[model samples]
Target: MANTKKDILTILGISIKPGESKEVNFDVANLHTSTPVNVPVIIERSKKPGPTVLFTAGIHGDEVNGVEIVRQIIAKGINKPKCGTTICIPVINVFGFINLKREFPDGRDLNRVFPGSSNGSLASRVAHKLIHEIIPHVDYIMDFHTGGSGRFNAPQIRIVEGERELNDLAKVFGAPFVLYSKHLNKSFRNTCAKLGKVMLLFEGGKSFHIDDLITNSGVNGVKRVLNHLDMLSSKFKVSVPKKDCILIKKSKWKRAKYSGMFKASATISSKVLKGDILGNITDPYGKFNYFVKADNSGYIINVNEAPIVYQGDALFHISTKLED
Candidate 1:
């Protein structure tokens, strides 16, 4: 991760000196009812100067699991670093959050618009503000997310392949898995990369659901990263990850063969061999039962948790390759 040093930090025109804290509003626009929405940006600085880290979540409104993780980081005072600055934006897409929807009110996916125009759509303006105002002052970013809908993902840190700095930081984050993925076009990660910012995108759990295990993984991983940077407070103790972090080079999704009620017997992050029974699809009248088998021997990273499925719906995401 990159590090920037300065005696004073100014964000959104607010000048914050060392050992100061402030809550600034990332004001985008008001609701349809003319209510002013407050997207609070919590900033904490230590007496000593160090790197500036930005922690953000809820870019996709329904990804409450990610929001919970950031909330815990702030609630537990983990954002109060012993050195440097910590900025927390627990809910970036507050518009979507209020409506319990995934996209902006204008039906735009916030993550798809990056380095946005100031006079574009609502989502674009928000994106433009974030990239132009907040990102410039930050050296490192940790954005949190979860599976879109029914698919439950194991805790993992995702980064583009072949970057030693990202790989080293991902290892320090200490998540259960580190998946090498390419950056999506116009994504926040891609924009940050273009701006020479180091970011670790965290994915886990499912949208609109909060899992304690997943929450702990994210919070702990943040602590580990802060500790590695020598910014963690002395009051908190960092725990070693329970398992070795697996590096996945390639993966494949197992789709359903028959359209029926589905149930997964295989759990996330478990290893399975070819031809192993992973789950089953059954008819409503109990007239038929079809067992879903693994096509290859690999680790299961994501399992669809929805009760119903179509024939082509994805059932399980399994790793097909690993990094040595």
Candidate 2:
């Protein structure tokens, strides 16, 4: 007979046996008002042990779309995996989520304070707890994100370009594009890489709001990934992105030439050529209007949403990988 006994998975002092789904609260810190803040976690362990996958969101409290994506997956179709385990943390920064901000109450960027220390600041301590306690157990990770304040991003996956494993997973995630960006200092992505876990980041829509297109793509992407890992039921048909996902190796931002009221001429996913007028910053009194033209031909992945802009403000994130 085969050995059915599997290694126990414990998080926040709570043990989840195989074929179990547990919802638990992980106490991280307290507010100035003495309100206890906790990270809500959901774990699903399969009867057949395999890879442990982590799905995290809400590192920035104001980014609500990611939270919705998690809810979509759980409420719509995702159940216990057929093999391995799945852990989902819809909100990681409870303090920031409470205040609708990106940073912790102590004004620290939670995403930038990874590998946290137990004896450090609130963000640092939370990071420490996550890095040491949660991350070490997971073999794969997907951290969801969205456009920052006053910015908007098309549904996309951002991964470290040269990492084949992660890049392959990103392709399986299947967004409009696979974007390569510089790794941030002390970010969870960097920390996970150092620990030898395959992690990728997904971005879509804008902060504080939801777009059906972006949200649907996100939920479907997660399902596809699970299917690829053979964690889903055989009866389930995997999904693909609405369009072919382009691989963007090189991208640049077009900046405003003059400080004024800004307007965009092209939206996300639109293809533009060199010298295309993407947007303009006009003088308040309408005396002068400056056109922000693309320096090179590319696809628009992100667009600035703010009405006002200063010279050199980034207006569009364009990828040179166009055609097909």
- The prediction achieving the highest TM-score against the true structure is 1
**Tens-digit lDDT track for model 2 on 217-255?**
888888899999888767667876667789898888887
Q: Give the TM-score of candidate 2.
A: 0.94
Off by over 4 Å in 1: 1-6
Question: How close is each model in CA RMSD to the real structure?
Answer: 1.2, 2.6
Query: How many Å off is the CA of 8 in candidate 1?
Result: 2.5
TM-score of each candidate structure, all chains considered together? 0.98, 0.94
Give Cα distance to truth, residue 146, candidate 2, Å: 0.5
Q: Per-residue lDDT tens digits of candidate 1, residues 101-212?
A: 8999999999999988999999999999999999988889999999976999999999999999999999999989999999999999999999999999999999989999
Pick the lDDT winner. 1
Against the reference, the lDDT scores of all candidates come to 0.94, 0.84
> Residue 220 deviation, candidate 2, in Å?
0.9
